[model samples]
Target: MIRYRFGQDDVLRTRFAIAPLMELIGAFYVLRRPERYVVHRRWLKWAASRVGDLDLTLLDAAAPFGGPYWPVFVSPPPREPHATIEAELSRVRETPPERVLAEITHRYPDRLPAAARPFAGDPAGALGELVEQMRALWDAVLGPRWVTISALLESEIASRARSLAALGSRAAFADLHPSVSWEAGCLSVRPTSKSATDVNLAGRGLLLIPSAFTWPTVWPRIDPPWDPALVYPPTGIGDIWEPADTDHGALKSLIGCRRARILQELDRPAATLELAARMRVSAGGISDHLSVLRRAGLVTRRREGRRVVYARTLTGDALCRPST
Candidate 1:
């Protein structure tokens, strides 16, 4: 990587600096609000210890969906957000993604030089292709207003870019050779930490997915073995509460495969190796599905050192009409 005098590298450098700054600020923010973290930590500790998705599901069921974080209903996390570890996902259902991207580019020129940089070469083409794909995704789920989705969309992309730049490919996200994305409303994030050198890439399964498009948006991917229908219609304050039965049309379209089926199997909860063994597949296979499910809001991932555990969502339990 060649460094230009205040060129793309500088832009990446600034982003790297800012993400940690926000993270640090957020950490301090939580520390200052120790009570919030404490209350959440206590509950999360319980949830984490509980083995199956049923127990965790009960917690989500017990708690009001939007009590602590409202943005999730507006823009759910890449994974389920219980009382602990909340992330902001703004709703832009009323704005156009193209327009939003324009506004963002207009606002932060240095941070986003992609818009200003002249289109040329493969990188330029790849970036353009990625943007176009995001635009399509925004349109598919959000329709016209998805144009505003570009801001949040680009935020994810830029954040990843910065993380990779700062952390280095190995120290950064694991799925390096191939990138992740959401195609035709199907999430496409991949987690890979296959190390080639001294890089201690945890490869805790890279997830480029987020938490906004849970069921109603992604049920099409669930299969019998993976997600045995067990849920109740979600009747919350901000979401499409007690909505109609599952949209069979959409689900039918979501082509479930080995990975999708395994996710359905773990609709409860399982460790990395357990899920892999039960599904008769590779750990990476389960990790991939978990990453996608977590991103789609169907599953959740929590960390314990180098290993991050996985489980299904309670709201989804309601959707599946789980008996117990």
Candidate 2:
């Protein structure tokens, strides 16, 4: 049971952000325990072969299966709302040797495991090698699907924003998760790890991160020198890997099969790359369909960072929604 006491500043400072590395870490967890993540069965099927090719020896050691203490340097809290993998990896690469040693010591108070010896002996060199492995993992596995995953995470953040706007903090976070509760001036989170401790935000405020792979559990970061953070499964997990709607038969008849799929996927805003990947089509092909949808007022495009994402307009939504 970890309790976080939030002051006025803490409440004001609390903000939401997406962490790419954190999602990568969550993927590791999924790879380690596929049975626990039934929601990702589809993804697991697709990623199994891809994941098997990589030598995750060190990465596995860093986030060993069934452990309450993984080294913190592997996946640090994201400082930006829309963090990129490149930026996050750089942070891991820059972690001080002492910091790495401290975290390893904390995780293994008895004797350092053989796998962790490299980190203790040469944190910098080990970290560099670890970062390279992480890059390979990203490029081969997570990078391709990051677009859809990111769009899903962004949708969750938008929903949270609306809830915060409409219901204020208290009510908005009332049902963050069964393990979480907001009462009085403290936010209590019951993580699987039994580390009973209290944290005062002072002013750094908690970082609320929504992750696709952190489903069925919430991970809390209470260690010092890093801002308090809560990484939990976002809403809409069951449908994450499931086809938007295989029963879009009527919609398909109305608008060709290809266009129907593109529209259906637009339930959450997605960039051309994501649309192309999901539909197994080319970027140019998706762009053509999106242009048609945009002109028809069925979808709208807006720039988010370096990418432009498309979301369904009301007409598109109504069209996709089933009629009683």
**Top candidate by lDDT:** 2
Worst 10 residues of 1 by lDDT: 226-235
Superposed model 1: Cα runs more than 4 Å off: 1-255, 322-324
Over 1-324, each residue of candidate 2 has an lDDT whose tens digit, in order, gives 999898887876778999999889889889888999999998898888887778777787677666677778888867789877888999989999898888878888899888888988898888888899899888876876675677677778888878877777897688788999999889999765856989988888889999988898898887655688888888877776654433578888988889998998876678999989988889999999899988987886766569897877546765774432
Q: Clashing residue pairs in candidate 2, if any? A: none
Q: Report residue 226 deviation for candidate 1 (angstroms).
A: 42
lDDT of each: 0.33, 0.82
Best candidate, TM-score: 2
Error of 2 at 318 (Å): 15
Whole-model lDDT, model 1: 0.33
Q: Residues 1-324, candidate 1, lDDT per residue (tens digit)?
A: 100112223223322111111121222233234354442243223333332322122112111132222111112222321211112212223333444344334434445334323212233333334334323332222322111122233334565566666775443334321332322212232332222212111222222322222211211111211111111111121232222354433443462555445545654456889887887778886677677766776655666446666654543333332221
